[model samples]
Target: MTTGKEYVTAVFEKVKAQNSHEAEFLQAVEEVFDSLIPVFDKYPEYIEENILERLVEPERVLSFRVPWVDDRGQVQVNRGYRVQFSSAIGPYKGGLRFHPSVNQSIIKFLGFEQIFKNSLTGLPIGGGKGGSNFDPKGKSDNEVMRFTQSFMTELQKYIGPDIDVPAGDIGVGGREIGYLFGQYKRLNGYKNGVLTGKGLTYGGSLARTEATGYGAVYFAEQMLKARGEGFAGKTAVVSGSGNVAIYATEKLHALGAKVIAVSDSSGYVYDKEGINLETLKQLKEVERARIVKYTEHHPNAVFTPAGGDSIWTIKADLAFPCATQNELNAADAKALVANGVIAVTEGANMPSTLEAIEIFLEAGVSFGPAKAANAGGVAVSALEMAQNSQRTPWTFEEVDSKLYQIMKAIYTNSAAAAKEFGEEGNLVLGANIAGFLKVAQAMSAQGVV
Candidate 1:
């Protein structure tokens, strides 16, 4: 009889052999597999059913070429991908990323992580992800519109409201979603719920833009409360100057916590007296400028042209990694722990490396995994689908209240699962086990496909 650890190792080896060159995808698989030993011991039936094998492989992988014309009338080509990872629980639901770094491996890793994250939301939505290596930065509106329309022309064939609904991610925000949704509507004759994160005038949900950031802060608050601590006077450091980081700063301030720093890809801005939200909003949202410009608005703030992960070294009570995957590493984790950081909540997908997570756990830091912590965006996206189905738009307060409740529920369930599995305060194990159990039962009931 194979032991649980051995079984996990064998399954992981198969994954590695098949996806030898996909470093990001393999890393995600290994992280999730490391926490499943206890689960396998409790239920050997999952192994017999080959659930791990099926779960790792996407149900359908679509790849196509997106050809568009630039503003200068030059022809440009980009590769696009959509990985429908799972549909056992419900229809596939995830975001579409648009950046230069997007590839099959990144998409697959994100799609795989989506499976567990969506499951943790307790919403009737499966896991999937799609993206294109088309950078929207420095592109004119006409160029972006042309590219989005071309991308949607092919993507429309595989997505629908009841089949698979795509939302926005890193580079795909409201403007891009509007263009994509318009193209989908023109092609398929107005299926409003097919794509989420649409503009307010269209069938978009309120609070969708701030859901992920607010949700991360809410989860962090829960973690602090579990330890008899609160965010009354604590200082925070947030990475990234995008939607997640911006709104996280807003919510942190509202909760009485001072956010001293925020970063972009080029560098970070450190303000000892707390970041000015209005300046950040104008710089990142309106102007779409780099984070270093923040120092220009506030002369007292210091702009450090350092690496994206450098924010982790700042002495603070809370840390939120809202940047890209693997941005936070073991060394950064050590710095945060040494600085007496109380809790770390992820606002991005797989932002922290496995080793960084281990170091934090070893130091007794209250860590919230991305799957459980950053589920707010998708949760609100699901709510948007509901509103669309009912032909009703909810107010900001209504949507925010529901989002808070969902995030609170996620924390409660993760903590309860940790306690149940004899790993109290270990949210990584708790999130993985709790999320896996849901998908496993659904797969079992549906039987082999």
Candidate 2:
């Protein structure tokens, strides 16, 4: 039998030999594998067929041109991608991001990460991710609508309820999902569950909007509970003003944490009054304004346009990075440590760079990796799939409570895996091993594809 180190080394060799992968994507995959060595030791068939080699790469990657017309009669074309990474346990499940950075490399990394994250959720959802390099930031509603419709027209061919179901991520939100779903329904007719994060008027479940953030907090709560602590008196600083950040702030407040700061791409607003959650929801969810504008409404809050770095400097017991990848780096991690931050939880995919994560781990903070912490969104998406399968909608409270339980269980399992591997408190190791074992077992039972 191949040793675990030999298996992991062979997997990395295969990864390095691949001609189609980008450096960032390869590095991300390598990081996950680096933490999954213990799991391979525990389950050796993963070494025989080299399951790691097969699973490290995506099963299929769909790239298409999304051409749309702007209101100015100008033609705009964007690159769209859907990477169905794995489907060992069930159908493909992930999110669709819409941003300038949505390239094959980034989407592949996210899809690869999703494979494990979905597995960790203990839900029968596989891993896939789709998105476009179309920036919806400065676009008009009509332009966005046209773009969404055009994108979905082609994407619908490759996705479905039982094939691949996608939800919102990053630049994509309710409006974008509405537009995509409208186009999808128009083409494929009214079959629910093809996409999650749908509008409630259609078939979206309750607590879906708040799942990622609330789930992160819920996972954090579990982590704290394991250590005889909780969020009751913690001060938190969260980054981003989008769906995840807003709801993360809301949940932190609900748990009695004073969420003192939240940011967007432009700037961050720090309020000593513990971040007015209602005011923030009105600004981002309703008004769709810049986060700096927050200080205009509340003169007491300090608005810093210095980006995520400013938020990292705030004194807090918890720091939740809910923005895009690499938003927090080594410098920011140092600043957070200087501020006496006790925990760093990722609400976005790889929000912290390698150096930042190393810093957090070395500091002995209760760090919750994105896969385990952010699995709430996909877990709830799986619940949405259940509702769709049964043709029945669960009440908001029911779904919310279910989400809470799943998050707790994920934390427990991930934490247990970490301890069993002799890497207690290292959730990065725990989550990767726990998630990998699930997918690997399913793949083993299904035989070689």
Candidate No. with top lDDT: 1
Most accurate candidate by TM-score: 1
Q: lDDT tens string, model 2, 1-449? A: 77888889877887788734575577578779889887778777678867888897789999999999999999989999999999998899999999987788898889998998999999999999989999998899999999999999999999989999999998889899999999999998998889999888888989999999999999888878877888998899999988788888888888888999998888889999889888899999898898888888899999888633468988899999999888889999999988888888899998888889899999988899999999999999999889888989999899989999998888889889899999998999999989988898888898889
Tens digits of lDDT, candidate 1, 1-449: 66778888998999999999999999999989988888888888988897888899999999999999998899999999999999989899999999999999999999999999999999999999999999999999999999999999999999999999999998999999999999999989988999999988989999999999999999999999999999999999999989999999999999999999999888888999999999999999999999888988899998888744488889999999999999999999999999999899999999999999999999999999999999999999999999999999999999999999999999999999889888999999999988999999999999998
Candidate 1, which ten residues in sequence have the lowest lDDT sum? 304-313
> What clash count goes with each model?
0, 0
- Which runs of model 2 end up more than 4 angstroms from their true locations? 19-21, 307-309
Count backbone overlaps in model 2. Answer: 0
Could you tell me which 10 consecutive residues in candidate 2 have the lowest summed lDDT?
A: 19-28
TM-scores of all predicted structures:
0.99, 0.97
Clashes by residue pair, model 2: none
* Residue 75 miss distance in model 1 (angstroms): 0.5
**Against the unseen true structure, what C-alpha lDDT does each candidate score?**
0.94, 0.89
